[model samples]
Target: MATQIVTSEANTAAVPGEALEFDDIQGLVFFGHGHLKYSRYVFLRMKDGKQARARAWLRTLLERKEVSTASGKQHPGLKDVKGEHALQVAFTYSGLKALGLSPEVMTTFLQEFREGMRDERRARILGDTGGSAPEKWQVGGDATMAHVVLVLFGKDDADLDVFHASHRDCYQEALEEVFIQDADMRQGDTEPFGFRDGISFPYIKGVPTTRGSDALGLPINAGEFILGYHNAYGQYPFSPRVPRSQDPGNLLPDVPRSQRVSGEPRPKDLGRNGTYLVIRKLRQDVAGFWKFVEENSRDPDKSAEENEANKELLAAKLVGRWRSGAPVELCPMKDDPTLGADSARNNHFEFRDDPYGVKCPLSSHVRRSNPRDTLVDDPQESIKLGSRHLIIRRGRPYHDKFADGAEEQGLMFVALNTNIGRQFEFIQQTWMNNPKFSDLYDSKDPIAGDNYDPEYPGDEPKDYTAVVPGFPVRQRLTGLPRFVHTRGGDYFFLPGIKALRYLSMERTP
Candidate 1:
């Protein structure tokens, strides 16, 4: 028998007049499934003239309860649920069209999602030039575009394989496989770069958890992540809708009154409880990263142990955290494995005390990613401004070895947000890829930025220069090579359970 688990709705603090409907949301939004160590992502393209069959297969899966929801019981925290697994499905703009959604309804989605991550202009903004260009992508490229992505999680490889094979058999006739990406958490919370990742995440206002305030010191608005709610800007994030006449089966919920203009027709909400999902396959060069650090940290006069310490310090400065996930601002002298392991203390520090980036560089990966109090003079104001651009990250690391004996390993990056342009894309363009970030001179994110894109336009700096602040003088590390490259990526729409059913419904003739 399945273990009975309480829903988050019963445990979380309710919003003033409205409570989050956890049952309508996908489990990925609530939990990372860390207990399920193995994962597989299968990308599919629907077969020509097989829209009906695809929809039928989707309806069958929904009926069988294959797709997981945000229930505390179904969460990985529970133990010994037999054949326990998680299955999530998302679609691209092409996928929705392939499923027969009307053009009128499709236009309502965010333009960034409609144009996709591979659009020429977007690629430039995201620094997808040189080796990271879309043409070089293994999947989600022109020749390998996919319509749908099936995300599965399992306790082990065998469990994942069994689940994947079963689902693959069900949808094979309606959809053809485009690519298969597999990931595992064998690194135990550390990314391929040998630093603890996934250490920071935004806490939604209506989500119940024992964890305290996020690094920003408060819970962000639910509408920032989920549709049909108020965002940080005090307005509903735009969501797609279908005409009332089209939803004849009444499979979808009515659009909230606040979201509708007085003169417009009241449509059925297709994006309620749904959020946009961003997927990126980043290839991390572990050997290249370490080699660069080792070469740059060398000093003939220094002792071997001292050189090693310098190397470690340089790496930490680049990432803004020690190898064990401790923020360098708290323990800059050395690694504190114990402190890093403590969730309460590790993320509590702010950059205001070390304004000059003496402890953590202004251009460091973590600092640039989330500037916290440093964005403005007033810490509280900075927090409010930063909240508008937060994203809920759910990425995992993957390792694969090719037949030629070459090893490939990196992160299967996943992020969820309501507005792609305002949240995810803003972070990429304004923070990660900006050479002028924090007024730094010709520096991009040392770990993940597109620092050396040869095909980039204009006279932008082609090489990255890391700035490390010190008392008397600042240290500059130049000639840094690109450490991470984007292999494949795309924007997808992860619909609510009701929207899923609505998508599976046929239109009235």
Candidate 2:
């Protein structure tokens, strides 16, 4: 189901650990390749001595996790997946501390994860306000600190029912969980805004098919997403190190830290077979978003038929794709749902041909986010640069009626990357939030970014300009406000099974 690419990295080298441990890793990472349907994102806090007791409870829960390898054989018993229930567990830095992990180990984490995402200034940059602000956020906010997040994937509601029963039965010890919030999977892969998602995933180096991802010869360094491997730099990503004495059982990989061009040692290998996970709750203003599209879509002199056509055009330009998930570059004039439904035809378009900002605007959501040769002349260089900023997203939509005084729904934005600063944060700040992106003046990302024009600062009328290409006169739409905003989010580390077991301190090899 992957689009064909002429470029392939045939000589891409790989690190040790040929096969990924399905049980140790969470199935969410692979996107069920397409088998999974329902998902429950549960965030919980450690209640006092719950860490010690939770460790034991985690061991019991591990047995029920449905892990699969490269071969995705479906089980007939399950309605959605051919496999059993899928589960993955991750602990935030605070959660790790709650588990009694020493400060020495904790100090090695990234500052973004340590300091967190609560500052008002940063919130403004991320388009986080209203339902997405920390005040209304459920987890990883100033109000609540979640220690662990358990992602459970089931075939259907019946499957989730069974999971709830198992969770209750397994945790009879009164773990005193501080708080728990659940984000359910929507019926379709579409978000609340009704745009089709879960397309455009990266291809891994060693692992051939991640079910849902393309095995394009353009294989990315697995270390970019996983620990203990060669990254895009052909060197191991910077990770934490511990004394050999701490892991005497040889459960962890013996890899050097602070690797440059050559393999070198730093200290502990706490990051091997693990990746940094960023979880953010972004609430979409569904009504406000569509209203903006309708009001500003037409020119005063345009005919009724022309105005109706322009409405969809305006909305599609914002996302760089149609509601059917078709890229504007491929279907610039009209949405081709047939082409959009086909993965091969959907994502196989280039922006180099649209230099004058006609087909897809430079500041459009997809273009700003990925750029993809739109930034430079050489496709190879663009691909190489894009590879560095690539991230594996495991996000799902959440719904809560009458939330924030409105029907509340947003994406549980989860992503995995070796370098949080370089990958996730870079995209949010340098690309998505930056008002001036790729030579565009006074316009931020049309959808995700806050439409903040610095020229008209503080209480003045602020508006964003979108230049739509045309034959006679290019159409310009202005006065756009922020649509999507961040409510709450935090950084956590999703450890491999071995790493999780090692964190438990119960299974010593």
Candidate 3:
């Protein structure tokens, strides 16, 4: 019932430092299937001191991992191509330690990875405050010990059998195969709340992200999402290194002591070809979300027909995009499927023209997630500044009907970035979670914000006011409800093939 993601078998297993093997890196990072019907997230914990076993399993899995350019005339097993699935992997801070990573390399990891998403400082800044602190996370305290994430893709359960048949025994023996989470792809590209997604991804060089040179968005530097390249700061982000004795063969890139960026200097290259990864299990209240919009869209003077139409329009104002995925910037008052489906046009619009919240509201999800050219006066400056905060988000919805067929369903939100501070967390904290964003006061991300703050009376949540010009009175929805909540997630590092091999073969000092 799900669409299958296909790849070629001509993947290169290169050990070259700068040349990244698209095949060795997870396929999910670069590909998405609107028809992908089945997805399984296999969580893992390292067995006690079984480094040898973990490495053995990893080496074998890496050989089979899907590569980037695997299409056209390829392996015989992928005849249908659409029916095949792919598997990719990454490791958390504790997971890396469990695999025998030493303190020296550990110290070189990002603060978010080393300290985790549960860091008290980050919790408060990102609106994870009050009775439900970071400690309330599903994987809190000692439970942050998740080591490996096995991202499995398939059209259905049957497709995954190939993966299990090949590595099940080794996975069980070498590492603890924690519970596997299967993401629901029932609504196609839409989330459970019924909104189309994955529509606007930034085009990056060398990754094969966009189809044409004239794609709506501008192409960004690969370093924005990958390590070892010039980042948004025009400087290479800090890469980890170890003593030459720890990696005598120089399988990794070496940096002299004076070449250090910020952290303490080391000789061996452990941080090269690696990127920071963020994962969050967000639970959504689909019914409550629609109900709130319906109730709030009502007006005594408006006729029933007018109020009925206002339901979707009001929701669009909050989301900054119609359920059809057509951006409100382009179709301010209507839904256009043809435009939404057109890759050439969907992401072509910007917010600089509609500055006064005439079309997309200031607090809308799109504006909050990506302010675009609206954040600054000069369009060129806004584009330049905004590009610095871009992040590659990869999320899949999960749905499991309850006995009443009303169970909780949400998305497995995943993000890729080199600097969690400047890229991912900055957007979440400074933009999405911020109550006052972009010169607007008391407004926040209407769809994904945690508006509850004890700083307000009755610990009551604040409202998101939407302004549509020429309408005279603005539409304000009071008694705002939190439509999404974080259940669990972690920060991990997706090492390059060479770095992954190091994890498998070398025992760092």
> Residue-wise lDDT of candidate 3 within 227-295, one digit each (tens)?
766666666777666666666566676663445756544577676556888887777878888998888
lDDT of every model, 2 decimals: 0.85, 0.67, 0.69
Q: Where does model 1 exceed 4 Å of error? A: 1-17, 72-83, 454-463, 471-473
Candidate 3 — what's its lDDT? 0.69
TM-score-better candidate, 1 vs 3: 1
* Cα lDDT, model 2, residue 448: 77
User: Judged by lDDT, which candidate is best?
Assistant: 1
TM-score of each: 0.94, 0.85, 0.86
Give model 1's TM-score versus the native structure: 0.94
lDDT of each residue in 49-79, candidate 2, tens digit only = 5566777777665454333322234322112
Better of 2 and 3 by lDDT: 3
lDDT of 1 at 137: 97
Q: Model 3: how large is the Cα RMSD against the reference?
A: 5.4
